[model samples]
Target: MKEKTSSNAPTDTELKKWQGSSVREKLVQLQSIFETTKDAKLHTIAIGSSHVSFFYLSSMAAEEKIYDEFIPKLINAGEKSIKSMLEAVDSANTGELQKVLSEIVSGKTAVFLNNEKQVYLITFRNKAKRSIEEPNSEHIIRGSHDGFIEDLESNMSILRYRIQNPDLTFEVMELGKKNKAKTAIAYLKTSYDPELLKEVKRRISYIDTEIMLTPGYLEEYIEDDPWSFFPQMLNSERPDRVISNLVDGRIALIMDGSPTVLIVPTTFFAFYQSTDDYNSRWISSTFIRLLRLASFIIAINLPAFYISIIGFHLEVIPQELIVQMKNSVEGIPYPPIFEAMLMELTIELIREAGVRLPSPISQTIGIVGGLVIGDAVVQAGLISNLMIVVVAVTAVSSYVVPSNEMSTTVRLLRFPLMIMASIFGFLGMTFGVIFILVKLCKLESFGRPYFAPAAPFNLQGLTDTFIRLPIWLKKEKSNKTGSGIFNKKKSSARGWEKNEN
Candidate 1:
């Protein structure tokens, strides 16, 4: 029987030891030397030359296998025989060591010659990926509907296909102490802010971890304050959105093996924006923007409004509506706050259950829980019929914001406002709102004011911020200095047309 060797400490003697052996034996010996070390995906394969050959630990292994029959094959070379052999030896391009390493680590076969200093990389990577399809979250009418997939290389290809510019740069780095997950940053050198870029690089370099699951994982790590309810970075799946942010001097961080990309130096108001705003007509887009703002107010404040009015400001209710409201709440022994809390908690549970379930069952959970529980609770007098109405409207309004992160922020803020309304009525609600605004005003994204064009007051950037003004009317570009807005080119100019033409 063959004796099994221990995977740790193969050396048995203190003075004398084995000098060298075959590659396979050496690998087995190394495995025994360091059993605790992980992430050693070592393997071996046959390398092709002019003819079939064998190689192992010693450089002379190939010469030992060489036969007299192979002499003719080596002599029968073509006009470009040397070039063909060199090309065959070099699978991937020169000056792309990192890319070669990436492909090799992703299960590709790489050949390291005993004589040559460099290694030849060839892909055997056959991991099946999802086909390109429309983005579910970010639908568009006029632009490309296809979104990024889980494969990082394919997503990078999408960007390269769109921009095709030399200035567009991609810097790759490995994160995580153990996993060493690959993370990349893409931005236009001419368009991005140098200081902001340095800051982003600095923050990313400071991340100390292993195996980042997604772009959001890094987002949580690099966030100015994770304890704060608001998200400091924007996670986007749309390539166009990333490109647009790049054009606006924002840095986009793309993680390898993760579908989502992150944009930094974002503001609170930036979350409220949708790609549809750019696709639609200015007048309609501006109206939609305002409507979304109203939805945010409705989502956060409507429930608190109802609580304050029913619990304290009874005079504000109309007489007929007051009678209906009273009828709805008559049998409920709990105060307005408790009723609101109960319904809110139920809604949250239903939402969470739906999200956690499988795709087919998630829809079922949403419908059954939302319709059934809401109806049953109202019938049992656990919550008022009017309160259910308020909850439904609130849920629908929360979905208006394009960003799920911001929607979650508003949802969380509702609880505090509800509690405050229950305590001091409208006055308490007002105080809570003032607190939120104060927090927003104080927030900073990479030292840049979060409430740009609003608090510090840059009138020029407002051409597209809250309102989607006409393209022609947007004469000025975004100013990073918070200075007066002025167009580099006139709003109407034939010289620009000639130059562009």
Candidate 2:
């Protein structure tokens, strides 16, 4: 018998010709096209005696024999699982390629051959994943006990599980010209503002970058203006957080391989929210939300405020407290800003070093670093006791931001305000504050107002904006209707007093 080879295999001349072409072209030119999927760990290709099994790195399970045995059993169960492919078989594709890949990677198995135009889908998906855990950054006592995981399907499932209405739509687009990163846009088709959805989709679709390694990549690409320091998109890992936005006429984008989900068409207020708000007592939720907002203001302005109070406006503080603050500053030679900046920088260094170091050393670094540095700096007469207090409060306040991105933005923005206050005192600090507010006003996330329901003043949204009002108050959905709260009141509430005597 003569040996046989695939006729499509490229020769030397053809291979060289494709060398100048793009990666996709080069891939198609080869005998086995699956080998060129970039993620070498994935892109599995096994040529068996009976059939060619082409699938992803993680999808194929058992062995070549398992399919042979299982296919026959599926037919006997009255399932037309694989009529032509097998006597009995189980199959599921749902007609979407993205969905197919997601299902397969999450545990389902798909089989394709070299000569086949269509693929055989099977439902033998078995995933081993970590048990659901709290989101470290967005942890709250009262929120849903769910969080996003690295799996894209798992993240989408989180959203779907919460908002199980047909009007909720999950639209996906491939980003990164080469990487082909999967990005899913989710919004309530009926509840979402058409203009808002269209604009978000437009910006996302226009992301022409080469690589979208994370949600941050797509975040930056779709930002209204790149230079703005304020985050145009709010990213969250909490499923409840994303669901809340979806119900409020917002869109969310989830990227594969990232635990974080991006909530688009966001306002500044969204970053201040947590899942706990909706879950807690109304009063407590309102109070905590207010505290978080106040903390943000205090965090960003505390150091600058200290400088202005001590260096420029001494009359503002009580005389007794002034005496104490002055006593605390007695030996310090540096100005309030310098002292403040030094301590802040030290704290940041300790924080960053702690993160980069091993767990054992990082804890020691945080404790020892704080004690040694604070004592040494005080002894060295470089900063005042009051400045230390200011920096400490600021650092703690920065942590109050639910989103890490917003926290970082707060920290970074604080520095410039500190510098400005240091140089020109209260006038400089005032200017910096005004600049930030103006910059925020100019910022937009996917064309919707970023300062919204606040800047645009959607009074109807106030019930759930800064405070999570009782469910009854929030029962009336946003004006954009389609996928929001309906009936304006709960059956439980309405039934309570309606049958009085």
Candidate 3:
């Protein structure tokens, strides 16, 4: 009996060598490699008196397309060779066992002719996927309603539809060892910084892992500071958003099986800007933009600020209000810190429970938990009325942030500030803020400063950072060139004077 090869044995070089010309021998080798899985199918067909063996995974291969369309075409085409008969788009002839195995696993059927050295691999992937719909997470009041689906090709097509420019380039690469998930890097060839592109490619190539489940897994490997609370790369399901970032000279990474695509070298300001800002009038957009910025501050600082004031700085309150506040918390059993933590934890649990349950049931839970349970807690004197208002406002403010990752970061950051405020009162919260600022200043996103137009202080870039400047007035500035690339002479954006009577 032939000695069986170990499954863990290296097959890179061995697979490159042709596995004997015998069809039955090849079948035995493939069955062994695939562990005789039921999904691995071998279909035998006689094409013009030549017996050909077609191998593919039933779960991945398009069964109807293969049996009806491809097989009939092959049988009718009385070509001299198997390669000539399988002359479809993306069709290739290969002798290497490695190539044949890879093609079959990737939803391509491999046609093996008896006594023939080469195998014809044809692409026939047709998997069921979710239909294109507006993303629930990044919904906009006015804009393109379509969002990216799980299929990488569909996502790329959506991006192509938005920007038909030829300069927009996409380079594909494979990640993960066992699964080998496909990943694509997209960027405008004309605008993208060469160094930035090289850096992104280098980082992705260096990701050594066994399995990459989603873009989030790859993100953890590529981000500059993995420990930082702020996400260096922005994740979005909207194709328009991806196109906009690509136009801005940034690179986008789209992973197979993940609906959300990632944008790199992003600034803190990018997270705050919404697609609605571009759709609406400049004045209204600017107002909402400023409101979002205010909400960020309120979300992170409100709880701690309340804890400091009520616990330490009672003198700040007016006499009548002070009396009212004292009366409100008079019967509360626990300290301010304990009371705040308990309410925060309860809200977090309810929020999580709502998220985990079905949509209709979750909505019911939110109403009952937010109103009924909150009122019960107040009446029981477990938490003060002011504390309830503070927690609710903070939660609402957090939702105002456009990026979900940033919103989550804001929620997580409050815990440390709350702890500090409990121990050191206002001083503790002040120190926590200072530490965060220092960290933000030190952080880098793909080697670009995270806090741009604010820390490094770019006047031209600042025009659109906090406020939504009119698109016509906004000048195209190269992120790499800084002020050197700006046009010296300013033209009337609207050309209103030329039309004047």
Clashing pairs in 2: 71-88, 75-88, 107-125, 108-125, 190-482, 191-481, 191-482, 191-483
lDDT of 3: 0.84
Estimate every model's Cα lDDT from 0 to 1.
0.71, 0.70, 0.84
- lDDT computed for candidate 2: 0.70
Q: Candidate 3 residues 147-182, lDDT tens each?
A: 999998889888888888899888988897766788
lDDT of 1 by residue, 282-370 (tens): 89999989888899889989999999999999999888788888888898988999999988888899889988889899999998988
List where candidate 2 sits over 4 angstroms from the true fold. 1-83, 86-128, 358-360, 479-492
The true-versus-predicted C-alpha distance at residue 68 of model 3, in Å, is 1.1
Q: Name the top TM-score candidate.
A: 3
Question: How far in Å is the alpha carbon of 382 misplaced in model 3?
Answer: 1.1
| TM-scores of all candidate predictions against the true structure | 0.81, 0.79, 0.94
In model 1, residue pairs whose N, Cα or C atoms come closer than 3 Å (at least 3 residues apart or on different chains), thus clashing, are: 7-32, 176-209, 176-210, 177-209
Best by lDDT: 3
Segments of candidate 1 deviating more than 4 angstroms:
1-104, 115-122, 479-490, 493-501
